[model samples]
Target: MDPEGARIQDDPDVKVMMAGSTLRKVKSRSWKKQRHFRLLEDGLTIWYKSRWAGRGHSTFSVTEVEAVREGHQSEVLLSIAEEFPADLCFTLVFHGRQGNLDLVADSPEEAQAWIRGVRKLIHKAQTMDEKERLDQWVWDWFQKADKNKDGKMNFKEVKKLLKMMNVDMNEEHALHLFTMADKSESDSLEIEQFVYFYKMLTQRDEVWKVFQDYSGDGEKLMLEELENFLRIEQHEGEQSGQHAKELIDRYEPSETAVKQGAMSLDGFQMYLCSQEGSIFNPEHQNLYQDMSQPLSHYFISSSHNTYLLEDQLRGQSSLEAYIQALKRGCRCVEVDCWDGSDGEPVVYHGHTLTSKILFKDVVSTVKEYAFKTSDFPVILSLENHCGVEQQTVMAQHLSQILGDTLLTTLLDGQVPQQLPSPQELKGKILLKAKKIGGLEQCLDETLTDEVSDDEEMADGDPESPCTEDPPAANKKHKKSKLSRELSDLVVYCKSVHFHGFEHARSHAKCYEMSSFSESKAKKLAKEAGTDFVQYNTRQMSRIYPSGLRTDSSNYNPQDMWNVGCQIVALNFQTAGLEMDLNDGLFRQNGCCGFVLKPEFMRDATSQFSPEKPEGHQGYKPLRLSIQVISGQQLPKVNQKEGSIVDPLVRVEIYGVPQDQAKEETSHINNNGFNPVWNETLNFVIHAPGLALVRFLVEDYDKASRNDFIGQFTLPFTCIQAGYRHIHLLSKDGTIIPPSSLFVNISISELTSGS
Candidate 1:
């Protein structure tokens, strides 16, 4: 016998039925037919083919095994059992070289000895046939114990077997049994545990279900479900190429092409065709390939200007107009609330509301509209024109209704010191202060004043005071101040939330020129946990000359450019001279142009080539028509003196269209000029769509040149566009030099439909 066969002899519970062919007759005719039946040492047997031929021979041995309790087949059960020693009482499979041997053990030493015996048998086995036979012995035992054909033996079966032997078993006890018997941790049991655990727990119905659930369909559960799902779907999508193309076409329109004057869909399509390497080009297979990754930059709102709700709703009934404006991309909404006579906060810009729009109605409308769309993320800034008492109540009510989604300004009761915790609302809250006391100091002062007034009531009888006693008039005044401060704070917080701290500004000065102190403002922002530094853009521009001077003067254009760049966000009064500069002749000159020429007869000449030359790079001087203006003086000599005359004196250039001729005519009208006769006049001819024109003044003496003054460069592109009125004002509202001279210009591209 093999060493494994030897170990089986040591296992006391292991029974090897070795009744010969004659003794097997009482069992069945088929059982009796087995002539050469060799009972292996591991409680399994093999019968020679002749004896097994007429009999119904199972591939596995017909013996009761302990470990095959949980619905596992005999073959599988024995295969699992052969891995460990027979002493440990657990129904788990053991992966071993000689298949799974049944563990038959009642003690750790006995199980160890059985395991040693099996190992010795495997080591000594010389021929492959002998080794296979030994393996078959183990497999046969597994087949006998496996009650209902499942492939695994679980803890329940092991516990039941312990219970049958009057030995209690818990999870720990079962794990102990498993660890001892399952030498390889492959969830298999050896002979002793297999036989004992199986007989205790095996039931026909339960075993059958276990077998069906685990290996009935003969398919194993895969480990890479998520990866497989994604890969399969992606493959399918790639296979349907047109579908993928359609998806890209529906979204991700080309922003660059759109910015470059591609207005209509057809225009965009044409541009794509013309610019073969552009994003919209379908032939470029790599187009949108990187779109799966995130974009490097995105556009965010810097700041927003809003009209007060009361102002807008003054003549209207509902908020439809305001809602429409919001749809047009207004980021901020302003609502001015005043305390009513009854102390209710009401929305109105003026002292009285002529319309029926109420505060509650507006709130309801805002909430309704907010629910309708997820795209519009609007922040509401409530300008509390109402008294302190009313504003606090209104703010609290609004907070309750809107929850944290709506960004609100700080209210009287919402001071950081007063809050139970730092204000952690859903939306941001900005603390607003016009002066240098800081938000905390302001709130403290307001609270102190309240306490001081209440001192009078200290001596009064506690019960005598009415439940709703009217507040003192002086107290009311103090409360009103607090309310206004709270309202301002709330507005500031709302601004910060929507446009970030950088865009928020103090409105305390009411559009005054001197409200902003950059350093002080920045300090205040730090205290408020914000980084916003607000300034009046127009005031800053006017007071601090942008340092761009054309004449021989101390100036710095680069510094001016730096200042402009620093002002990433600015508030502009759209109706002012700055607006005019953006829209008028200054635009025609160039977006960066600030100065106007002095001469009535303006000439524009480019010393450089009209088109950029290949590799020919250098600075180009822009030459203009120069004239000497004499204030109310006539030149002493004309062409008779033979001196150089004022080039612009007697020029009579005509045939230009009415729009093109207006800039020169306007200049002449402002200067009150008509040249003398008999003088070979030179006029800086400024015509539409022309590149450059020069004028040489003749007949007029050199001394007379001083009398005719001022020089200007008329932008030909502007003249062509029919904008005849020159902008006399600069961005800071300063008048350009020789304000009498006018030159029309327009250069920025206009939207196709607009």
Candidate 2:
């Protein structure tokens, strides 16, 4: 290795070079070219040369190497579909478009060494990227804090900076940050050291950091102070004053309380990030519940018009949509298939100007990403606009791309008394299209008798351009038959027509599924709410956005989910309040896209409604008292020169609310660096378990709509119910380090409840 390249070579993880490794021409899958590879600071670099082959060197961005693993030599060679003969050598595999670089090592130990070294490099690169991103964020905040642009921010300037970032800083917390950033122990911080201050504030990321700031010592937490921090600082005077001591004892038992006062930062953080916070509760019982029940037993994450990136008409439909949906834990996705000009079936929003892609491409993409984010079964909600010939092609493509993963029969070959659980269908794909054989022919007797395999066809999705009502009895309408090739793929998820609660009970069988338009489902809820819940108990029901959602906006997923609709489908491409609520609800339970239904809704014999149940009284109205204390490193919207933003912190509560649901602080100007509102806002919540709190940071502008900086929304159950720092995040949901609001939150049962 050259002196300049020696740094990577000298890495403790790096070792003796191996022999017989070469780069494969991806399209050709050839190994004729011998190559040498090394890890550079930013990426993986490779060199190849041969007598007949052109010598070249190239580098792939570290992020481009999506996956790396040790591989079997002969098996790997055969699997890559290359023409290489079986060889008993060690191999390493890197999977991605950056080129599937397969390297042969001299020994198994060498292969392991390479795998370890590459993984370490990948991790280091990713960390560095994140740190760089944070540095840029800090610089932006720094520039905004120094309004005068004198290269440094004074104590007053730093204080204002904290307010802007939604951080409430006392003299002590502020000074610790300020003096540390000023290595000179000076009274100010240079712009260059702003990121250093940010690291100090966020690196520990322990609740104790903030707790200590509010305590007498910069380390020890006092009982009285903890109580006040909970009651006064958190605006939660109603909470038990001894709450801190209890949490400390439960989570950080290693540390005994002080003689008089008790608590520590470690204990508090453990509680905050625990299931108690409603954040990452992997141990929650709901997540580990029996996954062996039928698919309908879960509130599955679903998407409508998943192919369209924007508008249904004139919008571009791409495979990316399927990948995006699958990665987000969407267990079910819609595809409208029409005959393409190339004799293949194409997917798009039919009868519209939406662009199209080969149905095969969608299938391939699904196969790749279906289990990437979650291992739950994926349901393909097929909307057919194609004829029999291409429909067969579509089925063939699915069968080919998905192979054994596509479910073609009941797992146990027995008539299911109930639907199988997601756990049972792991790595499997189910089709939610209509069956035309014994089921779709309206031969009710066939369903009553021993069921035979049926030929299935595509169902008319509500938003499908070709969707139409069943032909009237008076009208002589010819029926279309599904080819057996495509029909065989519709195993357990056979889509069935539902006439109503009564019709479903009388005609629909257990395995057949139903789809309902929003209006129809809402009508059912209003008239036969209990009956609908009963119907959903044994069979699957899908609710899609009505045709009226032309702009691709979303309906309230909660409304349908409340009724136990398993597949409450939405336009996954759109983002809004409805989408936010959907994300929040499904974010739990491993984000597997299949959340178990509530006990009341899941009980087959119980009659339920979203509103007050028959024997139960309505919920008690609750009051939330939230104090907007101060912000630290509040992000500014893109502001022009000569202008500093006025930031406002809004506390918006979403749920079944009886009155106006939001309150906010008056704008604090020029203090984006450290905004201090010290304002208390209150709200009366009607739905406690169904409630969510969203904290938004905005740049206030008089002449224009308030520009959004960022926000974070989490279920009310996640709130720590004490005085804790509320970390702020970017609009896209990435955390903005050192940026958070210091606030007190108090929840009380309303006395006005009748």
Number of the predicted model whose lDDT against the real structure is largest: 2
- Which residue runs does candidate 2 get wrong by more than 4 Å? 1-122, 125-219, 222-290, 437-458, 462-476, 613-625, 656-660, 679-689, 702-704, 746-754
lDDT of 1 by residue, 667-749 (tens): 22121212212222123322222222111122223353323332222223323211121212232232222122212122222
The whole-model C-alpha lDDT of candidate 1 against the native structure comes to: 0.30
- Against the true structure, what is every candidate's RMSD? 39.8, 9.2
The lDDT values for all models are: 0.30, 0.65
Highest-TM-score candidate: 2
Q: Which ten residues in a row are the worst by lDDT in model 2?
A: 449-458
Q: What's each prediction's TM-score?
A: 0.25, 0.69
Off by over 4 Å in 1: 1-314, 341-343, 367-379, 407-480, 483-754
